[model samples]
Target: MTDRHASAHWEGDGKTGKGTITTQSSVLDNNPYGFNTRFENEPGTNPEELIAAAHASCFTMALAFQLQEAGLKATALDTKSVVTLVKDGDGFKVTKSALTLTAKIPGIDQAKFDELTGNAKTGCPISKVLNAEITLQATLDQG
Candidate 1:
């Protein structure tokens, strides 16, 4: 397996200070975060947005892989992931993540698509890592 990494550096307090995060793989833009800005113009991308992106991409890829393994070809896969950060008892935490996916797969029935999607949700790396609940709504376009 290939290795990927990212780095973040922060100065001063959590709410007051700023931080710069860099994705070693060039997947994310460099941005800063602080009290004034949740995502800065000079620094890189925010963590929450990154997580959402990762989850979406991973889920899509997993579904495609599963379809291919099952001898089905996916013409298109569109996935949208929403990661919600809510107020917990003391601090903010990711409470839930919902994935909405539309897949156009050739020669695959609704039952097969549903099975593939279910497997993808469980197999996706990001989905497994997240502590919050992950829900997926998948639509398989036959035409």
Candidate 2:
């Protein structure tokens, strides 16, 4: 079992507050975020975007391992995740995460590809931890 940590420092109110996020790996060293970045689509990072990146990376890695276990190798795998946040009863809530994958696996059949991708989509840790709906769209490239 492995444990990872990240921290955030926030100041002021929710509407006008600002914060900096830091990860244990220091990949995000005091990255800035705030209401403007999250809601106004400013130039900065946001939780939803971070979740999207995590989901994409986790799902892709899971798929790679699944393919390896099945004795298949991929030339390339590209994934994109979109996380949707919406207003719920009294506050904001993450409603769903959608994954889009385009893969180049030399000797994989459509049926096998579907099986592995489906398994990865459900088996990835991020997917398991998320309370929102998860959806995947996968494409196999033979050319």
Candidate 3:
């Protein structure tokens, strides 16, 4: 099994608090995120956006491998994940994650493309980890 790590440090209360996030790869070294950034749409990264990024990247990679496994060569894959956070009781919870994708794979049928896309969406590690509702919308470019 492999392990990855990310950490956050905060100062003060929720609304006015400020924090920095750090990742194992140091890609997000001292990256700022807080209540304002999350709820107020301030100029900083938010947890939901991070989740979206993870979902998008993970789903795309899984689809690539699935395509290869099916003897299909991938010309391109463009994916987007949108995460929705909503109020739950006194706090908040992520309610949904929607993934949209467009792919270019030569000599592939819609049924097969859809089957692989569904497999990737269901098989992606991030998708498995998420507790929210996950949905996928896919387009296969035929040429």
Candidate 4:
């Protein structure tokens, strides 16, 4: 088994506070985030976007392995995930994660593509860890 870690340091209050996020890999080293970044769309990264990135990457990798196991190869697999956050009576809650996938795989039938993508959507580690609703839309690119 393996474990990954990330850390965040915040100062001040909710509306005016700021924070820096760092990951074990240093991909996001001392990245800034705050109310303006999360709610006001100021230009920095937010938690929801990070979750979406993680979900997209995890699902795509899972699908790649699934295809390999099925003796199929993909020229490209582009995936996008959107995480929705909403107010849940007392606080905020992540309600859903919607994934859109466009793939270029040779010699793959619609039935097989759908089945493999469905499996990946449910079997990905990030998808399994998320408590919110998950949805996927997959498109097979022939050109």
Candidate 5:
């Protein structure tokens, strides 16, 4: 099956501008930019949040695939990606992305898990796209 998704339009100057982000099922209305400073320093969806979401989702899926390839079933996979936008001389840039992951898998040893996680960190599409530093911390849950 082929699935497709889309988001609506955005315009304006960014810092003193305004726009809206719409998806297939949701619409972030009247998103503005000014004082709050994440998304244009006021109100709106910023790039960092988007990047975090993308990285988190991509990493989780990559880990799942890695586990399956290793003849193991992944019962649960949770990942959090923190994107840090820091001042780069004169402008702000995404300097790093820290990915924290917790997974539940039966019969997977620590060494194997660590190796798979490392491979997934490099194999994930988002991780491949960003030049920012990528760090991973993985916890394997045994029950």
Candidate 6:
């Protein structure tokens, strides 16, 4: 098994507090995040966006490998994930994550590509990890 690590530090109170997030990969070292970035229209990053990125990357990778295993070579796979954060009880909660995928593969049938896309949507690590509802819309390139 493999492990990945990320940390965030917060000071002051909840709304007015500030924090920095760092990851084991160092790709997001010292990245700033806070209530303003989460609720308000301020600069910086938020948890939902991060989750979206993770989901998109994971699903796309899964599709790539699945295509290879099915005797198909994918020229491109572009995916976008939209994470919805909704009010639950008192605070907030993630209710759903929707994935949209656009793919290009040489000599691939739409039906086969769609089957693989569905498999990837359900089989991706991030998708499996998320308890919220997951949905996928796939578009296969004909040109």
1-143: candidate 4 lDDT, tens digit per residue? 99999999999999899999999999999999999999999978899999999999999999999999999999999999999999999889999999999999999999999999999999999999999999999999998
State candidate 1's TM-score: 0.87
Residue range 1-143, candidate 2, lDDT tens digits: 99999999999999899999999999999999999999999988999999999999999999999999999999999999999999999999999999999999989999999999999999999999999999999999889
lDDT of 3 by residue, 1-143 (tens): 99999999999998888999999999999999998889888888999999999999999999999999999988999999999999899999999999999999998999999899999999999999999999999998775
TM per candidate: 0.87, 0.98, 0.96, 0.98, 0.81, 0.97
Backbone clashes in model 5, listed as residue pairs = 34-41, 34-42, 35-42, 36-42, 37-41, 37-42
Q: What are the runs in model 3 whose C-alpha is more than 4 Å off? A: none
How does each model score on lDDT? Answer: 0.83, 0.97, 0.95, 0.98, 0.82, 0.92
Residue-by-residue lDDT tens digits, candidate 1, 4-62:
89887889997677777777866544666564554343444566777899999999999
Better of 3 and 4 by TM-score: 4
Q: How much lDDT does candidate 6 score?
A: 0.92
RMSD (CA, angstroms), candidate 5: 3.2
Give the per-residue lDDT of model 5 (tens digit) for 38-84: 74445466668778998999999998899889999888898999999
Instruction: Provide the lDDT at 59 for model 5.
Output: 91
| Superior candidate under lDDT, 3 versus 6 | 3
Clashing pairs in 1: 30-43, 30-44, 31-43, 31-44, 32-43
Q: Which pairs clash inside model 3?
A: none
Residue 41 CA error for candidate 5 (Å)?
8.5
Superposed by TM-score, candidate 3 places the C-alpha of residue 97 at a distance from the truth, in angstroms, of 0.4
Ranking by lDDT: 4, 2, 3, 6, 1, 5
What is candidate 2's TM-score against the reference? 0.98
Candidate 6 structure, TM-score to reference: 0.97
Clashes of 4: 0
- For residue 11, give model 6's deviation from the true position in Å: 0.7
lDDT of 4: 0.98
